[model samples]
Target: MKDQITHLPDNADRSVAKQKFKITNWPTYNKALINRGSITFWLDDEAIQAWYESATPSSRGRPQRYSDLAITTVLVIKRVFRLTLRAAQGFIDSIFTLMNVPLRCPDYTSVSKRAKSVNVSFKTFTRGEIAHLVIDSTGLKVFGEGEWKVKKTRQRTPSYMAKVASGS
Candidate 1:
């Protein structure tokens, strides 16, 4: 008689393997990314000249609403890569800060709440498309802890997948 069951709280083996792929050549990676495209831009001469006449002197009120570019970058990446709230927050804090967006990055909870029910109706309604979605093939992982996966012999397997991880 024998009891054959292997149970552990976490996978220590995988963690070590993951650490091997550290970002050693981050500078090179940043240069390569710049070649692809960058969001930075100053107003062009012609564009600036044209808008000169249309500029208003000033609006008498409290200071205008301002959010850090980091937040916007995170939001944009979330839409582009279709990341979950937590992942989106992570993506921002990890790589997006390199862009120097000039604002304090919001915590994960702040990003989550804003993304779920932000004032997006205006933008959605103003878009040219009737359906409001140009290309909509995407998946979402809705769990905070991420996936539970282990390799049997190198093939990938999905234990579970969700669009919105519970416990928001």
Candidate 2:
């Protein structure tokens, strides 16, 4: 029995493909780009009032100073900036100072404890609205070895040197 090789048909016109999507609303796109860097740290009066009013004490423990919303906000800020819990607390404190808001920011311990119970909600577009999403991804290979083991075990030999040393 003989094996047969199959070949795909090739196109002669090898031209670069043009982009399919075009920006229709430049102003909206520009505004979105601008707003991406603008982090709104100032809490509104309603939010402040809600936070203050949510300090009702439970029967077993002391009164809560921070609300779930406040803790969730701190967690969101931490995630957005990729900050540690301590760093997030400091960042929130700085923002509060900058905004001159007379509200107490949650400590790192409080934020960590409340984060597990905080309920977060994200806004969704209506059914009639259409959203275009473009996703791009790159693959990364990870080695599951400690740095010390990797350094100790790593053997470097050129391909020619390896071939010659093996007497091949």
Candidate 3:
């Protein structure tokens, strides 16, 4: 039966071959790498024109100063940059000043109050191409006493690890 043996006796031959990939388009690859770390800011003319309230005055409370579109636009900038309401206000104001767009930015209070009613629409970054997303998570022990303290205190509680990811 030894002569008819069909399987290898060792796992050395069962190992998978390492994959080798070639980057054929160096210019595109380099541009993509550079863009990964780049930040872009854009403001269209239509947004500038519709910055202030255009609707007829309501027969109720004080008339609104900024339009819903303006509030939504500022809120979106806040979310994207992870900035405070005040900071977002200043940031947008700076952008307008630099672009020479004579549009008034909504204050933090106005933006916050209008946020409850404004329908903010966030657009996905897709250029008519299939986007492949890769997500990796790592758990980290953030809070808790040391192991020696736990042993001495006789309080062996389960530790909770926090998972943080990039671009999250």
Candidate 4:
């Protein structure tokens, strides 16, 4: 079963207290997530030096384990599997020893924020009819804004909380 976040503390204070993330019955979620993961085609910046030079240096100091290739691999796995951040986090953290990833898996926020930074453009592959050749494109979209409809309405659906977090 997937996780669902129905409501959140709209104005939760950060420094006042902390709510740690934990996953119980992790064996099942671990198997579920990993079984769903796959290593398919990948897109990466080939020119590492050039790519690094293009971005501003972080003030936090030298690169950390967070920058390791294994992390990127897992990020791709998460993407290919289309798992949410929490699912990935729980899944990976539960099986760190088994997978032997260098760093303990990052929490959902870290994984989601880092991967979500890759919103620049998308690369697509399409094939033309009656030909062996294929077409590739990126950043494809149709956009419209400032539109409203009175007849169309939105409704919220009810959801049951998963017992994994023990009702936190």
What digit string (tens of lDDT, one per residue) describes model 2 on residues 77-148? 565456998998888688768878787768899888866666544232222111111111111111221323
lDDT (Cα atoms) of all candidates against the true structure: 0.39, 0.52, 0.59, 0.38
Give the Cα error of residue 67 in candidate 3, in Å.
0.6
Clashing pairs in 2: none
TM-score of each: 0.28, 0.48, 0.52, 0.31
Which candidate number has the best lDDT?
Answer: 3
For residues 1-168, what per-residue lDDT tens digits would candidate 4 score against the true structure? Answer: 989967857676554666887889889989967754432221223412121223345777655334323334345435434687677667656554554433355666655555544432222222211111111122112111111121244532222111110000
Top TM-score hit: 3
Cα lDDT tens digits, model 3, 16-71, are 88899999999999998776565434454555565677778959989998876677
Better of 2 and 3 by TM-score: 3
Lowest summed lDDT window (length 10), candidate 4: 159-168
RMSD of every prediction: 15.9, 22.8, 19.7, 20.8
Candidate 3 matches the true fold with a TM-score of 0.52
Mark the 10 consecutive residues where model 1 has the least summed lDDT: 128-137
Return the candidate ranking by TM-score, descending: 3, 2, 4, 1
Tell me which residue pairs clash in candidate 3. none
lDDT leaderboard ranking? 3, 2, 1, 4
